[model samples]
Target: MAARSRRMTLPSLAGRIDPIYKPATKPTSDPAHSAAFIFLHGLGDDAEGLENIADQFQKNDKVSYMHWVIPNAMEDRDAMTTAWYRPSPLTAFAPSRPELEEEEDEQGLVKSAAYVESLIDACVRKGIPPNRIVLGGFSQGCALSLFTDLTSKKYSGRLAGIVGLCGYLPLAGGSQLQHLRAIAELPPTHGDVPIFLARGKGDSLIPKRIWNITLKGLEAFDASSVEQHEYEGGHTINGPMLRDVCNWLEKVVPKLED
Candidate 1:
């Protein structure tokens, strides 16, 4: 056994951001067989709040090949709450303002993006191959994950999958899409990275129309690589959704001990 490792949180982006992560327990002692799942939390939530959810995978005999990572958002709000970046309205078409700007910071977005990129580099350094890593998040975290996937040049290699929960792509309007196209296109990493997007049918903040737009934009890249699911509830995760996520992992991740 390669000495049972402990959780570690590291700083990134010139110390502007931090991410909390737990190394996956290897089913065996093989270093090359390990995988990682990076989890990003929603707005107003911190790494500690989501760490418990990551711990859920610890019990699965099939999950030992994977590590769970929860990256803390850049901005910390009242008490222990955190956010990746300030979220604006989905677009002009979004319903209600929905308290998007309690503390808006543009520079924070740049810093946050840099922080996430650094975290990915850290994962590679930790001996987990890029192709075996899955990046995921809830709400605001999902938005950041999508943005990072599309923008980061480092994402070209070793990206296995991306999971977005109750989130939408930040770029709106054709001009922004054109800019994204000029920089890079969707399914950015590996040319065939699988993407899973899950949302609640009753989510008031992220309405069905917004999800529709996201799906449309993703389809522009590689429709086959994108998969979407809608649950019955609102603005939160449910049991079936978790099961679906686990199943998705089983399919994408290699070397899972049956």
Candidate 2:
């Protein structure tokens, strides 16, 4: 067995927030073993919070070869918690509420998208190709992941898949929405990047109506390439969802060695 290389960097942001990303994991013994999963934590969570989920996959023989990269969101609050961005004013800083008024510039959306792009670039520098990378996040992190997947101009080349847990797609009628629509029109450069969306059936944060809207938007954008699953729970993740995620990864990621 060989030692793996891990690197970390903090990138500057426009506002007070600065994004910190973990370096890619390079398998020391097997340089050729290359696949990566980037996990983004939701509001009130830090990069270290997702370690349990990553550890779950590490126990899986089928996914042992994969490298996990969990990035901390830039907008840290209370000197302890982090969030993709400040909650929209319309929602009154509560994700459980809906934004009655639309944003003028989609500032939060754009900022978060840029932060994700920075993380991707860091991965590229550390030797992970886009095709072998799986972008995923939970809750608010899911929102950022979806926004990046839809708006990124550089998202075309290579991608393994995208997984969103208890998340919804970005709302329509903005620059972000337009970019997503345009990306949908173009031929998929990654050959139907598999999408897995799982939400708790009783999630009050992302109500049933919002989930329906998310599905509808995906459908409208020709995102028929999605897989949706619902669990009987609330805002938190459960064992079944984790198991399903692993199953999906087995189908999407390349095979691992014994």
Candidate 3:
């Protein structure tokens, strides 16, 4: 793919944290020929961390009109790093569903989900309809994106699609059974929105077993809505995985050629 040489203006914000934007490659050609893609970075990472990935999307002719938004996670004061929520410690022993049921584990997710909702609303105010916005993230960001969309009544049908990379749907059971129930009750259109989930089979931080449960739950909800991909890697985004995301985006978002 060629380098992205077009300059993109920073998106306007409304009483919320700002995000780094990969502007539509040809914004001046036609204002209406555009869509917004908002992706969140993984834990310990910031908005700039996904610039290279966003660059790759800018190179695709089919998605050149995408304005990719990468938001920074809230600063983890104790750890002196960024995190949307407290992720299980990186170890060979991934936490079991029961082990992940602590209420403390979900507080940050709730707080972060509010911010994610605000950001999407901000995009809508920018003239992009709710159905034209795509939400996604890597690792912890992926979990946050999924949590916000699945659990919030207001956010359910507001998204065009969801892209989750190397992450699991947290709190799928135990005390948070209400969340699972809410997701089950989502309208038919909610089930129709495309959702792409990719993971590294060898990922150490998140065991394949956990993701398997997530996949099954999603399938049970709407078999046709979820697409799964596994790569030969561990706990990270790779070339093939990104390519899949691009292809999925192309098919999911309508093309508006100049």
Highest lDDT model number = 3
Q: For model 1, what is the error of residue 18's alpha carbon versus the real structure, in angstroms, after optimal superposition?
A: 4.5
Clashes (candidate 3): 0
Candidate 1 — which pairs collide? Answer: 24-67, 130-158
lDDT value, candidate 1, whole model: 0.69
Off by over 4 Å in 1: 1-9, 12-18, 76-81, 91-110, 177-190, 256-258
Measured with C-alpha atoms, the lDDT of residue 157 in candidate 1 is 29
TM-score of each: 0.81, 0.78, 0.82
Query: What is the lDDT for 167 in model 3?
Result: 87
The superposed Cα distance between candidate 1 and the true structure at residue 231, in angstroms, equals: 0.5
Model 3: per-residue Cα lDDT over 47-144, one tens digit each? 77898888766775648767777877767775577888876544344456744543446777887887787777666766677677899999998888
The 10 consecutive residues of candidate 3 with the worst lDDT sum are 1-10
Give the best candidate by TM-score. 3
| Count of clashes in candidate 2 | 4
Q: How accurate locally, in lDDT, is each candidate?
A: 0.69, 0.68, 0.73
Error of 1 at 14 (Å): 8.4
User: Between the candidate structures 1 and 3, which one is better when assessed by TM-score?
Assistant: 3
Local lDDT at 212 for model 1: 84
Residue 152 error, candidate 1, Å: 1.1
* Candidate 3, pairs of clashing residues: none
